[model samples]
Target: MTVTSAPETYPETYSAGAYWGARKESPEDCARRTAGFLNLLAECDPFLSHWYTPARSRRDARKHPLMPPDVATLAELFRRGMNREPGGPAIEELGFRFSFDNGGATGDCATLRINGGMSSEAVPNHCVLNVPWRGPNADRLLTAAVLTKAVRAMVLSWEPDWALAGSSAYKMQYPEPDSAPFSLGWITYLSRRIGTVPPLPAPVRIEPVEDRGTLIILTPERFTVANPEHVALARRVRELLVQAGLMQ
Candidate 1:
């Protein structure tokens, strides 16, 4: 296979691995560090302002059992880690690797890869999260959450009777887009929902297909379409963004 190397001109953004490498501190310390980083991000990049909203409360968090508190902590860490150098904690602990790679002749830019998975091809310009799960109620709930977050675009792929264990199942794929920062946020957010937080590998491979394109390879279990509710949830998320003025 003709391996097309990554491109150049990507921008440097923080990654979970980078945060892990910074230092080791108590969870509270980490929280403070994260909050600081987010504040700094707001000052530097105007686009990230949308993500600066108040964090979900513990009760609210419990409602989404799949979402771990660490995800929120990591998000905060990203906000702070970017503002200052790696200190107070190690980036490795945070579960991300932030590096810059060229997207071939495109330009020199940064790419964020997970768990040494296919190196981040390039900062995504846009991102769409598709949740395919069984049952209409759960799917609607997930869709409501996605919409509340104001995702720009989304795809909800649904399948019924996925588990085959006399029950339904669901999966989601957040397609990469051109919106770099927002795309990262979307990944972080969805991962938390699926109980796949940072420091976890992408569970798939992103291989360069041809030109500047890529093909994501997923296992059978992960690819199965078992749930329709999640798919519907993703659709509502797209609508929510339009109503919130976050998407075009």
Candidate 2:
């Protein structure tokens, strides 16, 4: 995919504190949980093994923008997993080894390490999806759906709560001047792709307080669904987990 530059008129309103505070999952926790979630996805979908990797780039590291600390940590974890090292005690049961890297870009880069190379010709999933708002918003949404569908088809079939990070509406509160508009576009795109628009909570109001923005947290809905065709597969997996008594 071609990388698009950020808009010249992109507003600058991102506040690090506001964005972090609004997150239900801390960055570290999100990395670990995402790894595990993706592992579950791998069991259900065949495309996952094609999209993950454990390679690292030490050359010209300084040329790339500073990677998000969390992303970097996760990338390191994946590298370790590839070498068959313990790699942080398997934070979750899904056997997911995920880490992120900065790569000096606004969008985060992620790496997933898989054991015993599943496919001979499969390349690593190294593409980073940025969230800038310049392209046709619909295209942005379609791209997000492709990513999500790939994730669901290859990793886990479950959905998680998502928030729009860089919209003008959100920037009014947590002004992340460098944040990508990809996530926001993903939500809009995915809603249409699934052919079902889940009811969204009312937009939260942001009040300015002491030169900082205060967020009014809104309840988010779950995006999980079960279709009849997958009923047997889901039931079998549930039964195996129950028999193993591995509920955590």
Candidate 3:
């Protein structure tokens, strides 16, 4: 008798992010990084090209175009977004927080959230990109290849300790270890500050992200937790990474 395999389940949404421990920076510094990141992201995909500052209304949002990012404008936006205590003054330790998005239909759009300029070693500064579940371009843009570019863009622009791109479900299944620089994903970027990436078994490819560090591609196709093969491979790779001192 012939049997049919169960359908695979995948997360409805995916996200990419870069993270690093506290590093003190000014609004200008954060703006510079933000501008550079957006430019890199635009080159990664057409869907990621346009962005707008968050505002009370769509009309107001369009008044400020985040793309072709103006360093001066971004610096002003970051300054306005500074963490303040009630009505007292800007809290230096809390850092600057800002969010923007590529305006479009629900599924077609994406949000970029940023938190930087912190001085506390305990807090992590990050740039996160969130993509929706379904959309007109979803079929084409949501592939492992595109997501890998997104992660690479983040790594190149931020030069964070680590960066990752994949479904939220996969990340939930394999949360990042406190001592590890980053969690595995469809594409994971590790800074040299973390350590060298050791070789792994087949289908897993590793490439350099300039002089920054390495990019590990788990699979050329979609990686889903529902697939035992995918999960097993990720676990195995994680084990090897830890053994190689890339993770703890």
Candidate 4:
């Protein structure tokens, strides 16, 4: 495993706040719940073998840009994704000990994410798919069909009764985690750690937010534009949002 720089080191312990819902799962309890969910996933697909959450991945996800950006919007996304509202002791984020696979035991996959969050964000339902640059299945996992099936099974694991939402679109990213500089090499995680320059323009969602200038984000999926100029792109973003049913 190549060294990864802290793209953005979020506080080790998040403060208590209803801002991004609550983190109530004790580490041990959380682990137990994760195990149960993985077993449930096994029933969905025999190839859905071997699942465990990676501590580093969970820590990284905590800093996800869209995380509780605005509680109201986030809650709305959550309701749509989970078919239930946020708050309560349900779950905030589901990082099943990094058990994101359903393509046999070869570890041929990159990332396996489900909409465990209370919010599904802008892409119908949110998904984060990563294809490691140097994995055994690197060549075979390069098609949409493989990814779609994985995404579908993920939904089933958590919401077996709910009809899958956003079947046509799946949020995906091909991140070379081991040696990649996420955010356009500005953070230089790989460089600082090892002597690798992550290929760029990095996979990040960028758009101009009204007059807020251009905002660059590494969303779970959708919009991977890098360093867009605000004056030149905000108007376009609004129009795109409407077309995508994200805005009025």
Best by lDDT: 3
Model 4: per-residue Cα lDDT over 1-248, one tens digit each: 89988787321110000011223333343333334444543443333443333335544533443311233433343343333235644333441122233332233443445343333222222233344333445434332333334433333333221111111111122122332112121111111111212222334343322321222232223221232442124334334433544322
Report how far residue 62 has shifted in candidate 1, in Å: 31
lDDT of 1 at 215: 24
Full candidate order by lDDT, most accurate first: 3, 4, 2, 1
Top TM-score hit: 3
**How do all the candidates rank in terms of TM-score, highest first?**
3, 4, 2, 1
Query: lDDT tens string, model 3, 1-248?
Result: 99999999654577889998888899999999888888888887888898998988878888887879998999988889888989799889878999988877766778999999988777689999988668666776778888888888888777799898887887886787676667888788888898999988989999998899899998888777878899999999999998998776
Expressed as tens digits, the lDDT of each residue in 1-248 for candidate 2 is 99999877543221001011122223344455445544543443233222322235534443443222235565455444442336434332222333333232332222332222112222222212222223343233223323444333222211212222222333243232343211321122221111222233243222222222112222122111122322233234324323443221
Q: Any residue pairs clashing in model 3, and if so which?
A: none
lDDT of 1 by residue, 13-65 (tens): 11211111123334344344334433433332232222312224534433332
Worst 10 residues of 3 by lDDT: 132-141
Superior candidate under lDDT, 1 versus 4: 4
Better of 1 and 2 by lDDT: 2
| Native-to-model Cα distance after best TM-score fit, residue 119 in candidate 1, in Å | 20
Q: How many clashing residue pairs appear in each of the predictions shown?
A: 59, 22, 0, 10
Better of 1 and 3 by lDDT: 3
